[model samples]
Target: MSPHPAPDPLAARLRDVRVDFGTRTAVRDVDLDVPAASVTVVAGPNGAGKSTLLEVVAGTRPPTSGTRWAMAAVAFVPQRAAVPDRLPITVRDVVSVGAWGRRGPWRRLDPAARAAVDESMERMEVTDLARKPFFALSGGQRQRTLLAQGLACGADLLLLDEPTTGLDSDSGERIRAVVRAEAQRGAAVVCVSHDPEVLRIADSVVRLVDGRVVDGHLGAGATEPQPA
Candidate 1:
C-alpha cells in the first residue's frame, strides 16, 4: 500500500477575500496561500491595503466576501501599536500577556510558559529591560518588546506588520533573525514591511497594488545571507 498522503502545508488560504470600510473598499477579490515553514513578504505602495490584507488573514477583521482557512492559533503584531508611554508596566509583564491565550486570565505561567517568555525576551535583546518600565524604554525597545510578546504566544502562524520600522541596523537585524527563526520552526510568517533587511530573507513575495495581489512567487531572485 502507498504511504499516507502528506498533510497540507498551508497555514492559511484566502479565496476571493474582500474588505470594505464604509464606502471604501480596502481589499478586493484576493486569493493567497500562506505556506508553513516559510517567510512571505507583503510589499506595496501607500494605500495599497497591506495592513487590511493582514487583518483579514489574522481574523481581526471579517472579510466582506470570500472564504478564509486559517490555523486555530494565530499571533499578530500590528503596525500602529499604541502602547501608552505612561502605563507603568514592566517589559516582562508586557511580554507575559502573549501567553494568556494558553494560560488563560486567572491562571499563572507554568515553568514551560515562563521559559518561553524568557527565551523570547532574550532573543529580542530585551532581557536587560525585562524589569524596566515599558514606557521608559525607547520606541525601538518597545517594538522589540511587542515582537517578543508575539513570539512568546507560540502560535503556528504569525502576522507581523512593519516589525522593523524605525529600528537601528543592529535592532533591525535582531528582528530579522527572530522572524527567520520562526519561519524555520514551521510557522507561517507574513510580514508587511518595506525594509530591505526584512525582504532579503523572504522565501516568497506577495506584491499588492490597489488592494489587489499583482504577483506572488517563491525564490524570485537573489537573497541575502541567512542568520548563523
Candidate 2:
C-alpha cells in the first residue's frame, strides 16, 4: 500500500455535529473532515449511527447542534435506493439523472452531459445495459447503475452508503475500482461499508460506535488491509 498524499482542502467539515430524533440520539458530538482526492470509509455495527452521520455530511439531514460545511456540489447514493420495480425507466434513464444536477431539471442533456453519462456507465461496466429496464437487472447490476449515476453527476463530493453490501466479490471489486478512480480525479469519496475489501481502498477510516466516532485514522496502520 502506498502512502496517502497530504490531504487537500476539505469537501465537508463537521464540528460537534449532533443528530437527534426527538428523545432518540442518532449521532452525538461528532467532528469530521472529508478531504478531496481521497477515500474515507465509515464502518461500524448496525445502529451505530454510521448512516445517520453520512446523511448529515450529505446535507440530507440537519444536525441538532454544531456546524457542517459541505461543498457546493455533492452526490449521494443511499444504501438502498428505492427504484420501484414497475417504474418504466431504462438503465440509461437512471444514469442520465446524474447529469440533471449540472444541466438543470428542465434542460435536455447536451453533448457534454451525454458524454459524461456514457463514460460513467462504461466505467461501471453497464453500457451494455443502457437500454435495459432498470427493474429487470439483478441486485448487483442495479447497484452499479446507481454508482454510475453518482459518477455521472461530476460532483465534488460523493457519499455512498454500503455500496458493496450483498454484492458478489466481482461486483464489489468493480465498484471499488470506480470509487478509487473518482477519488484520484479529485472528488472526495465517503463510503459506509463493512466489507474489508471495500475498506481496503480507503485512504482514511472512521469507525463509529453508539453514534460517536470511536476511531478515525489516516494512512498505513489506520486500518489493517485485508487480502484480496
Candidate 3:
C-alpha cells in the first residue's frame, strides 16, 4: 500500500474521529479538514453533530477516539451566547472573556490586553454598550456582545455556530458583515448552520447527514449571498 497522506497544516484535521455518548454514538469515523483562507459551513439536521463538531474543535468537548488537530489561536462563538461570567456583567467585561486563553491564572490585564479588548468591542460595535449590562441588551445586541468576546480572543481562526440564530434580519446582516470582514483580515472562519443562506457567504459548504459528511467541495454559489 502507498504511504498515508500528510496532514494539511492549512487546515484543521480530524482523522478517524469518533465520539460516543452513553449508549449511542454522536459521531463516528468522521474525517474532516477545515482549511485556512476560507469560510467553511457545516450543515446538518438536528442532533446530526454539526454543533458537536464545532464543540470538539472549540476544545469544549473532546472526541472519544481520534486525533483532533485544531489550528493554533482558535476562537469560538457558541450558538446560545454564553455569558461565561454571570449575567449583569457589562459588555466590556463580557468581551474580556475572550482573553481568558491568553492570560495565565495569576495574570492581570496589561496595557496590551486592555488595547485588544478595546479594539474588539469597537469592531463588534459594542464600545458604546461597554457600560451596559450584558443581560439587559436586546437579542441582537447580546449577539454582538458575544461576538465581541470572541473577537477579543484575537485568534486567527474562528468557529461560529449559528451566529445569526436569534437575530432579526438587520442584526443577522450586521453579524454576517463582521464575520466576512474577519476573514478579510486573514482569519479562517468556520460556521455551522442548517440555514443555507448563512452558508451563502462561505467559501465552501460541507453537508453533514447523520454526522457523516456528504460533500466537502468549494462553493460555486453566489458571492455575498444574504440569508432569508
Candidate 4:
C-alpha cells in the first residue's frame, strides 16, 4: 500500500494561547498555525486583540498561558505609528538594521547581507530613497522602507501589523505585491490588516472578536483552529 502523505510542516503554532494585561485579557484561547508559502491575515475590529496575537506569534510578547512555537528566524514589523518619526537615520540605515539579527548592531554587514538589503529596498520600490532620512519620507514611503527592512532579515517567518493602514494607492499596491512575493518565495507571512483588499487576497483569514477567535479558514499546510 502507498504511504500516507506527510503532514505539512508549520512555521509557527499557538495552542490555546492567551495574554492578559493586568485586569483585562488581551487574547483568549487562540489556536493558530502558520504555514510556509502562504499569507495569513488576521482580521478584526479595533481592540480585538489582533496586534496582541501577532506579538505572541512574533515571540515578542509572551502569552499568559498556553504554548507558542515559531521558527528560529522571525522578522516582525510594527505599525508606522509605533515607530518614532524623528530617528536620525537614513532609509538604508533602517533596512540594514534587519541584518542585525545575523550580525550585532556594532558590526558591519557582510557582503551577502548588504546585497540582501539592496534587493529588499528594490523590491519595495524604495531604492531611490535609500540615502534619504527615514523621518523625512511620507507615510507611504516610511511604510515601504519598514517592509524592506523586514525583507532584508531573511527570516523564515514574517509578521507585520497594519502594513497598509494609510497609504497612497501606488505605495499600497507595492506593499501588497511584495507581501505576495514573500509568501511565494517560501516564507510564512502573518499580517494584521483591516484593508478589504488585503483580506480578500489572504490565503487564510482569522477573525477575532473580544479577544476570542470567532472564525478562521485554514490555508495550505495549516490545521483547523481549535475550539475555545
lDDT for every model?
0.85, 0.87, 0.77, 0.86
Local distance difference test, candidate 2: 0.87
The TM-scores, one per candidate, come to 0.91, 0.91, 0.85, 0.90
Q: Give the better candidate number (2 or 4) by lDDT.
A: 2
Winner on lDDT between 3 and 4 is: 4
**Tens digits of per-residue lDDT for model 1, 36-144:** 8889999999899999999988988889988877887899998756667678889999899888887886589998889989998999989999999987888799899
Sort every candidate by lDDT, greatest first.
Answer: 2, 4, 1, 3
Please list all clashing residue pairs in model 2, or write none if there are none: none
lDDT per residue for candidate 2 within 1-228, as digits (tens), equals 112322447778888988999999999989888878889999999999999999998988988988888887899998776778689999999999999987998589999999999999999999999999998998889899999999998999999999999999888889999888888898989999998987878899999999999998774334332321
Instruction: Please give the range of 10 consecutive residues that has the lowest summed lDDT in model 1.
Output: 219-228
Write down the TM-score for model 4.
0.90
All candidates: CA RMSD (Å) = 5.5, 6.1, 5.3, 5.4
Which one is best on lDDT?
2
When 1 and 3 are scored with lDDT, the better candidate is 1
Tens-digit lDDT track of model 4 for 1-228: 112322355788888988999999989999887888889999999999999999999989989998888887899998863446677899999999988887878698999889999999999999999889888988888888888999998998999999998888888888888888888899989999999888766889999999999998854444553332
Off by over 4 Å in 1: 1-7, 220-228
| Distance from true location, Cα of 50 in model 4, Å | 0.1
| Winner by lDDT between candidate 4 and candidate 1 | 4
Model 4: residue 165 alpha-carbon error in angstroms: 0.8
